[model samples]
Target: MEDIIDKRMVDQSEMSYTVDILNKGVGQVAKKLLEESSELAFASVEQKSTADIVHEAADLIFHFLIMLKATGLTLNDVSEELESRHKN
Candidate 1:
């Protein structure tokens, strides 16, 4: 049986980060996201190990999702945007 409950667990983690970031204010969340993004890009450009790059990318995405949630946006908004662009 395919377990469909994984999304909820992932969302709970995201929600916890969102709440923590929002408590510190949007600026903190934005700063963290920028840091994560820079690290990910740097790792990719520098030809880092695959595992290292993957770790950095995950941090970037987690922070990005926090920023999105802090700004009252959901992952669905991004998905919809990408989907719309695909249709175009």
Candidate 2:
């Protein structure tokens, strides 16, 4: 996913949503993360189908990766934090 994002960013393809959000800067990325999270929360609260929940979850995670990239972080950084907590 990071590779795809980097390629899209470099290619600057007008058709790529990743490029669009990244071009808009971190604020837009954060806004999208909030939006996706809200959709996931709504799906859960409304007792939507499992598929709906999973779909929303995937959206949230994809945006999360975008957010991490925008912030110069990576999944490994996040995993390390989680691992530290697990050991605590």
After superposition, the stretches of candidate 2 with alpha carbons farther than 4 Å from their true spots are none
| lDDT winner | 2
For residues 1-88, what per-residue lDDT tens digits would candidate 2 score against the true structure? Answer: 8788778878874568998887799999999999999999999999999999999999999999999999999999999999999999
Off by over 4 Å in 1: 1-18
Give all candidates' CA lDDT scores.
0.75, 0.92
Candidate whose TM-score is highest:
2
Worst 10 residues of 1 by lDDT: 1-10
> What is candidate 1's local distance difference test score?
0.75
RMSD of 1: 5.4
